[model samples]
Target chain A: SQQGEEDPQALSIQEGENATMNCSYKTSINNLQWYRQNSGRGLVHLILIRSNEREKHSGRLRVTLDTSKKSSSLLITASRAADTASYFCATDKNTGNQFYFGTGTSLTVIP
Target chain B: GAGVSQSPSNKVTEKGKDVELRCDPISGHTALYWYRQSLGQGLEFLIYFQGNSAPDKSGLPSDRFSAERTGGSVSTLTIQRTQQEDSAVYLCASRRPANTGELFFGEGSRLTVL
Candidate 1:
């Protein structure tokens, strides 16, 4: 069963705009990580936020965690056409080493 | 300097036929994982291996699916009597044992069942 669920199944925005995607999970997690996947390719790790941490940033990506709400959000600022891709959130529950991924949000940025 | 690598980037197999997919993780990484991604779907965990310990196979969909990690370096996922529903992109990932929270993924092997 999927432990995480991402909202806004699909989003379309203009280049240079900001894009935000939200993910909600069911259980306590050790960490929540986000990944990006281009068409017909593998996933690329973006950033990871530990359970104890509330937020983290890497380059143009920002991630926030709200354990109380069992949710996380990924923010991409100054989005570019190349940033158009599917984004997924994966959760590593504190109890298990396995990670469960959400259905993902497909973002399309028009140049 | 190479990342995780998977063989036969694309595969086409007839129903009931068996198939094997391979993964070679980055050097020195002791943790490996296998996942399946259906079209327009998120990743589904299949198995996980940490060093030489027993692998976690709970995510495997059926008895027909099995996997093994040899020498804690390379791993193989074998599917027997494949079904049309089995067609999906099989992805392999690896990370240092202490950093299992973050995974490095391969290009993935796309399987098409006929």
Candidate 2:
């Protein structure tokens, strides 16, 4: 089970507030990726942080990876109600580009 | 396809029946993957194929689970004698060789075994 685990299984916040989710994995990884899934929809890749890098950002999303701690965090600043979704962290440490996804963090932003 | 595509968006089957889910990856994507998500659970790694060859099938839960890719494009996952536990959303994703970018995903096939 190379599966990563995301903490704060569920989070609720108001619009314009920051939402943060953490993920921890058990093995070395080439890269870690975060994805957002709207209900009943396919996942949308949000960001990917390489093991060698500590942080990366895309739009309002900021991702930080701490390899020494084997963990990562995703921060959505100034979140909107539209940002509500299930966030998952996936690690590409297994063979054949296979990914082990975390249990996910369900975020709900109130309007 | 513009993106990874999966067929039979929803399926309701009786226990002990066989079900086949299909995936059509984005054009020219060489890496294909199959994953499962039980309700309210994390994604479960099932298998991945590189250019029509599956080098890793370790995540498959049992003999009843199998997957294959043909023409290096489309893939199919077959579940035999599905139990209630086999019910889940099967997701497909594809990426280019050596690319660490985002993996394109399909909407997924939701299976419900009664």
Candidate 3:
């Protein structure tokens, strides 16, 4: 069973615009991490926000976690064509380290 | 290896045939995981290995699916009597310990069941 659900299945935007993706999970998590995957490749870890931490930033990526709502969002600022790819949210429940993944959000930055 | 490694980047097999996928995790990572991703679908967790024992094999879809990690380094996922529905990309990931650290993944094995 999928533990998380991500919204905006697909999004297209011009370069320099920002992209936002949201994910919601059902259970309490040790940490929520965001990952990026290019076509035909494996996932690349982007950032991890602990349950106690509300927000985290890395490069142009910003991740916010609201455990109260069991939801999290990923925001990409100054999006570029190279940022075109699929983004996924993985939640590691406090009970274990196994991370459950969401369906994912596909973003396309048009140059 | 600096990162997790998987073998036979692509495999095409006939129905009823058996297949084996291999994963070699980073040097001393004690945690490893297997996941399956179908066409444009989310990753479905298959199993997780802590050292040589698997505490969670609950995500395995059927009896045909099984995985094992040896020497706490290399792992293998085996599927018996493959079915068309089993065709998917098998991904392998490894983490350091009992931490919520990020998982490092392999390129993945694309299995095609015909």
Candidate 4:
């Protein structure tokens, strides 16, 4: 079963706009990580937010976690045409080591 | 390898045939994972391996799917008697042990079952 489900199955926005996607999970997680996929090949890790951490940032990426709500969100600042891709959230359950991924959010950035 | 490596960037097979996908993780990484992604779908966790412990196979969709890791370095995912539904990209990733580290992934093997 998928542990997380991302909102806004697909989104379209002009370049330079900020894109935000949300993921909701069922159980407590050791960490929540976001990834990007281009052309549906392989995923590239963007940022990881540990359970104890409420938020984290890396370059143009920002991630926030709310354990009480069992949800996380990924924010891409200043989105570019190249940033158009599918984004997924993976949660590592605190009860186990396995990571479960959510159905991705497909973002289309129009140049 | 500097990053995770997967074999046969693409594979096309007839239904009912068996196929094997291989993954070689970065040196010394003690954790590895395999996932399947269908067209326009998110990754479905298939299996996970950590060190020499028994793998977590709970996510495998069926008995026809099996994976094994050798020497904690390379891993193989074998799908027996493939079905049309098995057509998807198989991705492999590796991460450091017992840490909140990011996973390093390979350019997945695209499987086409006809």
lDDT per residue for candidate 4 within B36-80, as digits (tens), equals 999998888899999999999988999999999988889999999
- Per-prediction DockQ: 0.81, 0.77, 0.83, 0.73
In candidate 1, what are the lDDT values of residues A10-102, reduced to their tens digit?
Answer: 999999999999999998888899999999999998988999899998998999999999999999999999999999999986754789999
Q: Residue B22: error of model 4 in Å?
A: 0.6
Q: What lDDT does model 2 reach?
A: 0.92
lDDT string for model 3 (A1-111, tens) is 537999989999999999999999998888888999999999999998989999999999999999999999999999999999999999976765679999999999999
- On DockQ, the candidate that comes out on top is 3
Candidate 3 DockQ vs. native: 0.83
Q: Residues B56-87, candidate 1, lDDT per residue (tens digit)?
A: 99999999999998888989999999999999
In model 2 chain A, which range of ten residues has the least summed lDDT? A91-100
Candidate 4 TM-score, C-alpha based: 0.96
**Per-structure clash totals for the candidates:** 0, 0, 0, 0
What are the per-residue Cα lDDT tens digits for candidate 4 across A33-91?
Answer: 99899985689988888899999989999899999999999999999999999999999
TM-score of chain B of each: 0.97, 0.96, 0.96, 0.97
- lDDT per residue for candidate 2 within A1-111, as digits (tens), equals 788999999999999999999999999899999999999999999999988899999999999999999999999999999999999999976442778899999999999
For candidate 1, report its TM-score: 0.97
If the candidates were sorted by their lDDT against the true structure, best first, what order would they fall in?
1, 3, 2, 4
lDDT of 4 at A32: 88
Best by lDDT: 1
